[model samples]
Target: MSWLVTGGAGYIGSHVTHAMCDAGIPVVVIDDLSTGFAEFVAPAATFVEGSLLDGALVEDTLRRNGVRGVIHVAGYKYAGESVNRPLHTYEQNVTATLTLLSAMQRAGVEAIVFSSSAATYGTPDVEVVDESTATTPESPYGETKLIGEWLLRDVGRSAGIRHTSLRYFNVVGSGSPRLFDASPHNLFPKVFDMLYRGETPRVNGDDYPTPDGTCVRDYIHVADLALAHVAAARRLDDGLPVERVYNLGSGAGTSVAQIMTAIRTVTGIDFEPTIMPRRPGDPARIVATGDLAARDLDWTMRHSLEEMVSSAWEARRQAGDTYPR
Candidate 1:
């Protein structure tokens, strides 16, 4: 039986699909190619172009491929933009996930690894967040993600499905040149687009209480995140214990200033970042503890700040127009 990876054409999902294939697992992908590119899906995996909203299509894909598990990474992921489109966000992230879970139950696929976001904790008061942190999402995007988690838990209780969600913040870098961050809202691609167009990168705020007077945020390499998903899947397959949720993070995070310095060094650019006024509700620092993940999900920060910048820069340069259109 194969593993079904929804949105396997997306940056994170594509990496997970390829990583699962690397582990000698047969993989089947279901993606609508909405924001994701069809080219990103690995040839080794069977690809089905469809939406998660189409329950019959999803169930057909699962049954046709003899899928034993699911890795759900499909959703509308822009937090700020979600404010203007809450209905779309809820439909894609919540309603779509419900459809997926229902189909999985009907098909008897009992395992899943959900791709979640740290945005679930809206401006957390704690310096370092763990699974126990309160979820007070500040945006529709985040609210939907938390709702997705609740759906998973409720379904697990009713159907005995084995599942876990990995909550992460500021996912950056790339696993390969073939894959790169494509979101217009993501920091890496946003910075790369600015620099590539010979424009100076702007720091939104620099007067925060962080060590460098800029926001300190966790930015994990996509490959590291993908590996954690692989570990979660393997444990579920092997009937090993796994947590309800894992925070994929580096305990100590990189600040905006640190990111600027790394970009300057990696791209061989001698430009200093331009500073602007702070955006409202911007926190000084928000990081997460990966101790639980390290113990159970094989999570680790395999790339340093410099390595993350370099790898992301290379992939963005390779992506060209794919970065920002």
Candidate 2:
């Protein structure tokens, strides 16, 4: 089946593109290269350089390629940056989604796998959040993602479109050697960059309510996350549900200290990190309850913390410099 991936040159999107290619699926990619690199797009997939806000471009690309389904991964993602620039985040994350949905409707595409985030559930009252958890986004990035999910849900309620919103936590690891590209915005890549420059990684906060007094998150390997998308695509093809949402995570909370330890252990970098105060809107712990995803999508993450860190390190190493430098 032919597919279109909106942010196909991005970190997670590139992995998804590679996964589809490995499965012998025809794919078309559209990326604006804002944060994504064109080199990361899989060689097997057709690439279009443009933004999702370009509705005409999105529509033309979808119709021309005979795209049966779309995996929407295009948008702004930095939590801290979103807080500093709410309007930009809303425009890119929320407004762009509205345009994309309109374009999808125009193209008569019936299936979509939206890339959502755990941020939508914003500092859940429960230690582990599931699909049934209440959403209270603390950042514009999170709020916009939730808005995108709502748009899909509303559209699905009235239109013939079927959707699966995958709310991700900390998406780690690299896909293939060719598709591996690092983002400076993420924790692992920032740490990798610091270590590469013979500098110690800086931890934003060390006084959270967690065991290590630091924020905790569920880190899922990017490859496994992509596989989960594939599973969701298969389920949609089977006509199981018109609209569904699943939180994609490992169900294990890894703190900042644990991440630092993993990086040093995996990369043989014996460096200490400088701890500072917690950033605003930082959650103490944000783990996932992937039971629903496991039951419905039959998804499981196979890579460990060490495996994910090592893959990211290898990818950074191969890049010769931090991506988008």
Candidate 3:
């Protein structure tokens, strides 16, 4: 039996696919090329070009591929942009997840590892958040993700579907030179893109209470994040107990300014970032403890800030002209 990785052609999803493939897990990837590149998918994994919104296609893929579990990762993931595109976010993240769960039930697929987000704990007041933190998502994208977790919980209760949601923090770095994060909204790609074009990187809000007067975020390498997903999937496959939710975090915070410095050092690009006004709804700091994930999924920050920057920069440089504008 194979595992189905939805959105397996995207940055994080592709890394997960590679991790699974490397671990000898047969994988089937279904992705709509909206934001994913087909070439990013692992060569060993079967590729299905479609959207999870298509219930018929999803169910068909499950039945035809002997799929036993799912790693649901596809969604409209821009937290800031979701403010102006609430409907699109909900449709993609919420409704599409509903469709996927319904399809799984019909196809008798009994396990799922959801690709959740730290956005679910928007602007948490605590210095370090755990799974017990209150989920008061501040954006439509965050709301959709929290809703996705709720759906999985309810489904697991009624249908006996084994599941776990990995609420990871800012995922950065590239596992391979060929697989790069191409998001126009994420920090790493944005700065790298600006540098490639000989433009100054912009940092929003440098007047915060942080050490460097910028937002502090917990950054985890995409490769490390992928390993946790595989561990959760294996736990499901082996019928081992799994938590309802786990935070795949670094247990530390890095400010935007620090990230820029790391980028500068890694890329050997000496340029000060252009500081801008604070974006609305921006949190000063949000870090989480990965104690639970560490205990259960062998989660840990395997890469340092330098590695995160250097790897991403290497991949961005490798992409060269093909890197999405």
Candidate 4:
């Protein structure tokens, strides 16, 4: 049975496709290439270049590929920008997901692994978030992610479709030199670009209430995240019971200063980062405990900060200018 991975040309999605196919699972990819590159998709999979908004194309892709399940990773993923463009965010993430679900139901596809985000939790007054953290999303992007989860929950109850949502913290690093995170808003790429250009990386704040005097966040390797997706999918494929939502994260988190130190160490940059004032409403700390995921979905922080930085650097160098600026 073939598994359909939407947005398979994207950074995380492409990595997910690679992980699944490496396990000898048949895979099919559908991506519009809006923010994704067509070159990132693996040639082994049957690829369809299209958007989830195109209902007919989605249905056709599912039916044609005989997809038994879907890994719904397609969405407008920028949280900060979603605040400025809420309509576009909802249309792409929420409405587009509805379209995909409709096609899945029509094609008798009953299993899905939704790519949810930690943004669904917003800023909570908790030390470490778990699956049960209160979901009060602060941005359109986070709201859309929550709505996608709601869609899966409601649809599952009504249609008997087995599904799960993997809500993760900061996703960084690359599994292969051929694949790297190309997001402009992401920390890894930003620092990578600066160092490559012989510029000092900038840290937003360094006076937060933390050991390192910087905000702390869970940072998981892209490869580790991909492995969790495969594990979740495997559970569904084997008819094993799994939770509706799993938080893929590190129990503890790395601070911005810690990250900067790692980046400097890895890149051989002698300069320290410039510390600017914290952005409005930026929390000092927000980490999650992946105990549930660890028990069920084989989730773990398999890569260290140094490893994450090194791998990302290697991939960015490999991509050269082809990587997004």
Per-residue lDDT tens digits for candidate 1, residues 1-325, read: 9999998999899999999999999999999999999889988999999999999999998899999999999999999999999999999999999999999999999999999999999999999999999999999999999999999999999999999999999888888987888898888888899999999988998889988899999999999999999999999999998899999989999899999989998999889888999988888999999999999988999989888889889988998875553
RMSD of each: 0.9, 1.5, 0.8, 0.9
Can you write out model 3's per-residue Cα lDDT over 168-217, one digit (the tens) per residue? 77999999999999999999998999999999999899898888899999
Candidate 4: minimum summed lDDT over ten consecutive residues — where?
Answer: 316-325
State candidate 1's TM-score: 0.98
For model 3, the stretches where C-alpha displacement exceeds 4 angstroms are: none
Write model 2 residue lDDT over 1-325, tens digit each, in one string. Answer: 5899889998899999888888778999999988788888889999999988889999999999999888888888888789899999999998888898899899999899999998899888988888899999888899999999989989988996899899988888887655564666788878877787888889998888789888888998999988888778778878886337898777777898998888878888788899877787677888897877888777787888898888888888887754537
Worst 10 residues of 3 by lDDT: 248-257
What TM-score quantifies how close candidate 2 is to the native fold? 0.96
Candidate 2 segments whose C-alpha is farther than 4 A from its true place? 322-324
| Candidate 1 ranges beyond 4 A from true positions | none
The true-structure Cα RMSD of candidate 1 reads: 0.9
Name the better of 3 and 4 by lDDT: 3
Whole-model lDDT for model 4 versus the true structure?
0.92
Pairs of residues clashing in candidate 1: none
Q: What is the Cα root-mean-square deviation between model 2 and the actual structure?
A: 1.5
